[model samples]
Target: MKKAIGQILSGNMLSKALGLLREILMAKFFGTGDINGAYRIAQTGTLVPINFMTSDSLNSAFIPLYKKYLAEDEQRAAVFKYCMFLFFSVVSILIFSILYFQSEYWVKLMAPGISESAREMSVSLLKVMAVCCPFYLCSGLVNYISMAHGDYKPMSMRASAQNVGMVLGVVAAFYSGNYLYLAWGFTGSYVFFSFWVVFRAFKGEILNFPIRLETKEVKLVMSNFWITLRPLLILPLILQGNITLERALASLISIDVVSALDYARFITDTVVFILSVPIAFAGLSEWASQTPEQVREKIIKIYYWLALLVINMSFFIFLSARDIVIFLFMRGEFNEQSVMATTHIIQGMSIGLWAQVVGYIFIKALSAHLNNRKVLVVMVFSLLSNAIVNVLTYKIWGAFGLGIGNAIYGIVMFLVSAWYLKIARSLYPVIIQISAGIVIYFCVYRFIGGYFNESTSAMLRLLVNGMVFFLFAFLWAMLFPFYRQGVIKVMTRKRLR
Candidate 1:
């Protein structure tokens, strides 16, 4: 189990490093604007179905069954191959039909605040993106096969390829100075990424596209798929509420508000991806292989370490919000107005980073336990609350309101997930540790902020204050015996050693 966890962590770290580089390049080139927003929306449309069908549902169902079949009979490899072929065929057809018929409606609905020119651009981008859906579906099949075969490195590299492709595409777009050509680059990347995965899976001998799909294998796959989808079917409604609210409220704002929100979110997501990926890759795969008792113990330890990590990260971002905006953005055409707009949004989002981290872990734990129904229920409530807040706030405060509403929603979700996890195991100690760390960090930051004169550079002050806060936090955690032990446990893991 430890070895498996190590493998996953190593792979995820590599993938995340490349992904971060891609984001830095994106920030440098595009900054925050209408073009980036259109790209995000178009990508979101392509991703939504792929997430539901493949990464989300297929992994939960296909993995255990594939392992079971392999353990029981070597000949069952044929069954697995046929099953993947059938799954891909059915999903590809469905995805193609939806994208073909509803691309215009979705584009208009998602960004109704944009101008006619932007809207047309968005629709065209969506059309190009639609072609990548089948590729993603196929890629998902290959990922499942690779994982089942215990060849996660290939799978990781395949995942990383998308980011590499995106980085190249963005450079191409920048050189050409054409948004339409940039959109094509984006589409081309996905197509290339899919082929890369397919090629790797073939090389690994983990995937074999059968000449014909067998009816028995089809039935077997369908049985597992239905079992998976039964719990996941409610996810779309429960999860998309916040996004739906964002689109609706952005439409009510000026033309650029949606684009602004999307760009700000891109920055927030970068932070999330960095912190969450390592914990998730290490924790989930480890927890999955543990016995109930061992799993419970591991969860408690991980929760403490994760809380500490998130607290530190949240403070760092919150204190350095302005500097980060200026440093990453504030380039050509990403003027003062854009910086101010994005800084406001990033500040609002910083408040929720802690909650987002906790919620991610809780959700992954639930999925591991096959308690998807419970998770679905929580997501539904969170989505509903997010919608109400987004609508009310947008009416009152415009674009900034959307950011505030999302922050509040994130807090609510974190509390709810914490409550659920607590019911499963006592979380009061973890909560106390996190609260203590935050209070101490903030106190130190305030002291440092007071001493800094008005004449000092904002970026310089931010850097100095952030270092002080982190130093204080580290000392504070070291002073607490329990937290010190937890830190040692995480840092001294065999993988790290």
Candidate 2:
């Protein structure tokens, strides 16, 4: 799991590094305007559903089954790979056609509250964005398939390629003054990636596609896929649908609301997802063969370690959100209002970042158990509560209410997954530790922040405050047995080397 995480982390780091650059370029070029809002919708609107079908929950279903099929019979596994690839390609291409032809209606469904002109822009962008659905679907398959085969490096580098596409679009749109390139550049990334991923998968000998297989062999693969995929299919519907609605909800306020909310999410979501996602992916692969009890125990241990780092991270983001926003995005059309808009949302969302780290693992644990039904039940509850919470609060807080809703959703997701897994009881101690850590970190941050004067630069204050706070957190965290041991082992290893 550690090795897998390292592989995932390295790729994610570069990818996210580029992602930051991409967001910076976007902020400078477009800011919180209708053009940016529509572009965001065009990109997010198309990709969200595509992600639902092909990413997260789908990968959970695919990787374990791929491993099982390969172990039991390599030939059958290859057949399954080809079968799934063919199946998704056909399905996704059909989806692309429908979305391409119906982008006008599609944009309306995605963000009904946008102005008529924004809607028109979204339609145009969605048409171009629609072209990448099949590529994303197919590329996701090869990436996961490659991961199953112990090839993680190419997968990590993939983000750079994809971001390179978006970055190009940003520069082109800035120089050429044609926003159409935004959609075009974004779509081109996935098209490039589909070819890149498949080639890597083939070169790694992960699977030899287009190989001869009997009708019976295809049936066997499909049968297993059906069994594996059916249980987890609705996950995307519940989870992804909730996200779409949330974005739509943002759109309802204003195009600027939609854009600001999108901007806010990019920062908060990256912080959470980048940290948790690799661990979840790697943990799923490891826990796939473990018993329920063993998996539960590992969940507790992972939570124990991961919670501290993430909680500190969340609080840091919360404390310095305004500064961070200003540092990252306070230029060009992104002005003080943009800073305030995104800063509030980032702070609101930070309240729940720690929850997602654990929640992701819990979901993966359930998926590893093939207990997708339970996963569905928890998500449904979380979605309902998330909706109700957002409804009641959006009036008060505007789109930033959605950020609070996000925190609630993640906390609910984590708690519910824990309850369903029968590990809720064991997690009590871990939760208490995390709570205490947050309280202490906040107090310390407040104390330390008092020393930094208004004369300091936002970036400089953020840097100094963060480093000092973490140094204190590190010293305080050493009082705990687990953390102390972890630190000692690290120091010992360094001395030996």
Maximum-lDDT candidate: 2
Q: lDDT of model 1 at residue 375?
A: 64
lDDT (10s digit) by residue, model 2, range 142-249: 888888887776667777788889899989988999999999888999999889887777777776764678998898788877887786677678777777788788
| Candidate maximizing TM-score | 2
> Worst lDDT window (10 residues) for model 1?
277-286
Candidate 2 structure lDDT = 0.82
lDDT of 1 by residue, 1-497 (tens): 45545565666666666766665666667765667667766776666666766654346556655666767764566566666676687888788778757888987777667767666767777877777777777776776677667666655565566766777777877888866555565567667877877777778766655455567766775676577557767676445535755765775675456556656776677665556654554454445556656755666766677777776787677667767767665666666776666666677777777777667667666556566676666666666777777777776777667777677766776767656665334666666776787786678658765547757776787778777777777887897788788668887896676
In model 2, state the lDDT of residue 444. Answer: 64
Q: What is the lDDT of residue 167 in candidate 1?
A: 74
